[model samples]
Target chain A: MLFTIAWRNIWRNKRRTLIVLSSVVVGVVALIMNDSLSIGMIRQMFENQLGSHVAHMQIHKRGFNDNKVIQSVVPDQKRVEEALRSTPEVKYFSRRVVTFGLVSSAINSSGAAIIGVEPDREPNITIIKKSIIEGRYLSGASHEVVIGKKMADKLSVGIGDKIVGMASTVSGAVGSDMFRVVGIFRTVSSEFDKSYVFISLGNAQEMLELGKDVSEFAIILRDRGLVEMVKSKIAARLGANYEVLSYADLMPLILAQMQMYKESMFIVYIIIGLALIFGIINATLMSVFERMQEFGVLMAIGMKNSRLFYMIMLEALVIGVLGTVVGMVVGLAMYLPLSAYGIDLSMFSESLTSFGVGSTIYPVLTLQSIVGILIVIPVFAVLGALYPALKAIRLEPVSAIRYV
Target chain B: MNIIEIKDVEKTYHDNGVPVHALRGVTMTVERGEFLVIAGPSGSGKTTLLNVLGALDTPTKGKVYLEGEDLSTKSRNEIASIRLHKLGFVFQAYNLIPVLSALENIEFTMMLRGIPEKERHERAMALMEELDIAELADKRPNEMSGGQQQRVAVARAMVNDPSIILADEPTANLDTKTGANLLDLMQRMNEEKNLTFVFSSHDPQVI
Candidate 1:
């Protein structure tokens, strides 16, 4: 009977009820959209780094990540190859000889990281082949090189143009070689694009004065979920001389930024919830004041004060649940199509590239966020009804009956 | 037998910081099975006296006893319990909960007392039939005339079979014919059930 009464009472002033309901609905939709966009941006940034060069994990000489010097080459290369071939989780791997050097064309010169990659294996691990904008991938021919578009612009070189690469060798001698630019690639990260140049592994080994030695082995796994297990397995097999680093270990800054974004979203939820609380309070207080005499008659007829309080709270709950359910339906209606086709942010591509995100982003909504919305909105609505419920209970029957 | 007793009950309350004495040294007794009226003009303390008798307000001085229980000594919840189990009330406005149908209004008090649904429905229907409002069972207060709404209110009060019914100007909002008919209905109930009634009114017809 209390439920029946409460449900009916809300409709007594339909316009007021709808005003409160609409505010709650708007708050819920805003929360859902905001959460989805943040998640999408973070996910895009993480995937961009992985596809561009990081892969699932990497194996390097213990100190190669800290100092890109020519001497810190991987130890026991034969043992590393045997372990990688034996591990079923290893889908594909690329051996690279990496060194910081200067590349110069006839017109200009710029600093670059010279990465020597196996033409056949490198394309399977990184997005360099797909990101090529102007030329073909390297064909393992002697003196063939693939340079980023940004680096090519700085060096004033294009495909088939000759450039000189100079770096320090393991023997402490200056190693210089002339190579033809076979490709010009552009990745999501402008910084990565401006600093990297790739050449065949054999050509790099010959130029750098290293015999069958590579700086790092970038590995792509059959299943990304097995990154930690495979990293531990590889680390144990290669012993203490080699370091196995997962994507998370290779990109701590991006991970920290993602975590910070999640925390900030909590503040957004609180702001929306607080706004909803005030809206509900205002509506409930008006309803309570309007029905003062009716409440008096209820008290006079022996309705318990606690029952009256519950009735008011129940009305607010109905409004909240109704609004939240509608909002979720509307939010999902918008999210599904956006997730499928993605939201084009090409207008901000330059800024997005700086953050390692592509022009288009696909928003994602998790079950956890859905559960959070369901719990939070109704709880706030009930909290908003608290003061008005107390006011109703505090009325003296005689005075309330006489209330105009 | 005295169903209610009031001894020098005085009700003084503040109206904008000015203490207005609505009742002063008033003493009265109501017998069982009596149809009694506290007749007075406006501002004559008639409603205040009725409020005290109904356990809706506390007196500033003296005591009000209902069936030998001192209402002034009881706590708020205790007073509410007393009102639930022993008293019924009808306001001049016919205060049927506007959201409820006529039948729901009649069953409301019984529902509050935790009566079984089947029994509450049976009693409310029987009373609605007795009051000649069976056809209007599904109608809301807004759909009903003033006389019909008051009949539903009276039926609501009587559904719990309270020991006494306190009415504050029950016929003040009705036409003469309707007020006379309502009085006749109350007289019939009083004679048939031997139920005690207390009324506060300035109406000559009620007097």
Candidate 2:
């Protein structure tokens, strides 16, 4: 009977109920879709910009990561490589030898961070090959190189162009050699595209004088969620010889920046929720006060005030569920398209890159986001209905009857 | 048994700083199978007295006893239970839920008590047919005329077969013929079912 009354009353003023339901739907849908999209996009940016390319987890020489030089290379590479291969979670594992060097093109010159990687295993572990926006990816070990899109523009360099590498070789000689640019690629994040350059492990080893030694061991896991577990096991097995750092540990600065952006988005979500709650509260309060005479009549006919209370609360429940269903559909309709192609933020490339967020981010929908939005929304709507339900129950049948 | 007892019931209201006594220490008793017409001119406290007797309002100061139980001692829900099982009401405006059809309005209290749909439907249909409003049962309040709606309301009141039926200005919104016909039907239900009928009205036709 309570459910019937609530359902019937909703249709009494169809237009009024629609207006409220539409607002609720709009709020809920926008919230659900937006929440899903943003999370997915950020995850994509990190996996592409950091985790996938760099491996969700990495292993390093215990003290070598802090110093980061050719001399600090972890010597027991064969053992570490075999251990990573043997682990079921490890899908791809490779060694990295990194250093800073000055590269001079014909017309311009700039200092760039060079990543030396094995040509064979690089494509298997990272998305670096697919992101090549221009020219061909690296072919084999040679004096050939691939420069970032921004670096190419800044140095007036392109495919078929020659550049000079000036750095200390392992033999303590100032090594200088000219290398040809094989490709130029741009990733989603501007900072990465602007500063990063790639070269073959053999060429880097010869030029940087790293003899049979690499400083970092990168691993791509079958599941990104297993990063911490993989890192812990790898670290424990390697003992005092190596340090295993998750991508989170390797790039503290970028992670911190992304965390800050998330905090701001959370604040905005709260404001929207608060405004919606207020609207519902106002609507329900007015509805209760307006129906005092009706409630009095019900009581007059031997209807219980408690039943009236249930009736009012059920009305809110109806509104909340109706709005949530409508909103989820609408919000998803908007979000799916945006998440697929992503809103092009190319215009703000420089600033976004500086903030460590990709210029193009496709939003990802997760179960947690949907559940969180649904659970919190109904509770809030019901809470908003509280005042009105209480007010209806508190009406003195005699006093209200006087008005009737 | 005296189905309803009102003792020294006094009800007062203040209107714009002036005291108005809607019911002035009036006492009344209603017995089973009684057909009582409570009549007074406007402001004579007839509606106020009816409101108290119907348990729609508590008197400013007084006691109301229903079927040997002090209504004041009952919880609000208990009072509602009594009303659900034992009382029926008809008003001048009919007051049918605008969204419900005539048949649904008649079955509403039974629905409140969780009565099965088939039994309720059978009873509601019979009641409407008896009042000759059977064809209008499918019409909503707005779709039906004043006369048709009043008949439906009376049918709704009778469908519950409650211990008592209270009518407040039942004829105020109806034409002479419609009002007379509705009153005659109530008189028949009172006589046939041995039902108690109480009405408060200023309209001569209702009296």
Candidate 3:
């Protein structure tokens, strides 16, 4: 009966109830959408870094990651290959000859990381094959090269154009070669596009004069969840001489930013929740005051102050539950299709790429986010009702009955 | 046996900084099964005295007792319990919870007493039938006429079989015929169930 009364009391003023409910619903939906977008952006950035060039894990010679030099070539290439081949989790691996150099066309020149990749193996480890906006990926053809769109633009070179690449060899000599640009690729990171160029492994090895020695082995796992296991296994096989690192270890700054964004989302939720709290408090207080005479009659008829308090609290709870459920349903309705096809931000592609994010973003809804809303919204609603409930219970029946 | 006793009761209200005396040095008592009227014009403290008698307000300078227990000394919760179990009320405005139907309003006091749903429903139906309001049981207070709503309020007051029913101008909003009918219904209940009735009104019929 108390439940029935509380439930019916809310609808006594339908417009007021709905207005308050709408505020809560809007708050919930906004929180869900905001959280999902942030998660999606972070997830996309993480995946882009891995797919562009980082792969799932990498095996480098000691001190190579900290200081990329021609001298720090992989010490035990055969052992690393053997371990990768033996590990069932290793889906694909590519050996690269990496060096910093200058690429020059007839019109311009720019500094670049002149990477030498095995054409067939590199495509499986990185997104360079799919990222080709013009021309084609490396074909293992001698003197063939693939440069990023920004780099090609800076060098004023295009497909079939000849460009000269210069780098230091292992013997402290400047090794330089001329190559034809076979491809121009663009990735999520504009900075990466502006500075990296790819050529055939054999051409790069000969140009850098590193015989049978590679700079690093980039490994992609069949299941990304096994990245740590695969890295540990390969590291154990190659011993301490070879440094095996996962994508997380290789990109600490990006991961840290992702963490920071997630933490900041809680503050956003708090702000929204606080706004809803005030709204609920105002609406409930009005309802309570409007029915002062009725409440007085209830008190005179022997209804306990505690019962009256519970009744008001129960009304807020009903509103909270109803608002949350409807909001989640509506939010999910909006989220489902957006998550599937993603929200296209192509108009802001340049800015997105500069931030290392793709033009299209897919929103992700997590179990933790859903659970947090379920707990938080109702708790806030109840909190908002506290003052009004106390006020109702404190009213003297004799005076309240006479309240105009 | 006396169901209520009041000794030198006083009630004063502070409007802004000035004091207004609503009740002063009033003494009263009513025996069980008694049908009594506290009649006076408006602002004569008739309702105030009834409020004191009903345990809805504490006397400013006197002791008000219900069945030998001093109400002023009891905690607020204890007073509420006493009201729930021992006293009933009918207000001038019909004051049925607008959200509840006539039958629900009648059953509300019993529900507060933690009575089982089936028993309260049965009792509410029986009382509604006795009042010739069984047909309007499903109607809300707003859906019913003033007389019908007052009957439901009377039924609500009697549902729990309280020791005393405190009515503050219960028929103020009703027509004369309706007012007379309501008084006759209360008179019958007082005679039949030995229920004590306390009425505060300026109506000559009630006086």
Q: What is the per-residue lDDT of model 1 for residues A61-101, given as tens digits with 9 covering 90 to 100?
A: 99778777889999878888899999999999989998999
Off by over 4 Å in 2: A105-109, A167-177, A223-229, A251-269, A285-291, A353-359, A401-404
List DockQ for all candidates: 0.84, 0.54, 0.89
Q: Residues B109-140, candidate 2, lDDT per residue (tens digit)?
A: 77777789999999888888877888987888
| Deviation in Å, model 3, residue A98 alpha carbon | 2.1
Cα displacement (Å) at residue B140, model 3: 0.4
| Candidate 2 lDDT tens digits, A1-404 | 56777887877778777877877887787777667656765666666666335677778788766876667777699879877987899998777778777888888888877888887888777767777888888898488888888888888988899988777677767877788989888776666776677888888887787877887888888987898988888788888878889888877765776687568667756776677778778888777766677677677665677777778889988888878877887878888798778877779867766655677767777776777677767777787798878877887775655453
TM-score of candidate 1 relative to the true fold: 0.95
Candidates 1 and 2 compared by TM-score, better number: 1
Model 1 misplaced stretches (Cα beyond 4 Å) = none
Per DockQ, what order, best first? 3, 1, 2
The 10-residue segment of model 3 chain B with minimum total lDDT is: B198-207
DockQ preference between candidates 1 and 3, better one = 3
Model 3 lDDT tens row, B1-207: 888999999999888979989998998889999999989899999888988999998878899989999898898889889988999888888889999999999989999999999999999999999988999989998999999999899999898889999998998999999999999999999998998999988988768
Instruction: Give candidate 3's error at residue A14 in angstroms.
Output: 1.7
Lowest lDDT 10-residue stretch of candidate 3 chain A: A228-237
Error of 1 at A252 (Å): 1.4
Error of 2 at B154 (Å): 2.7
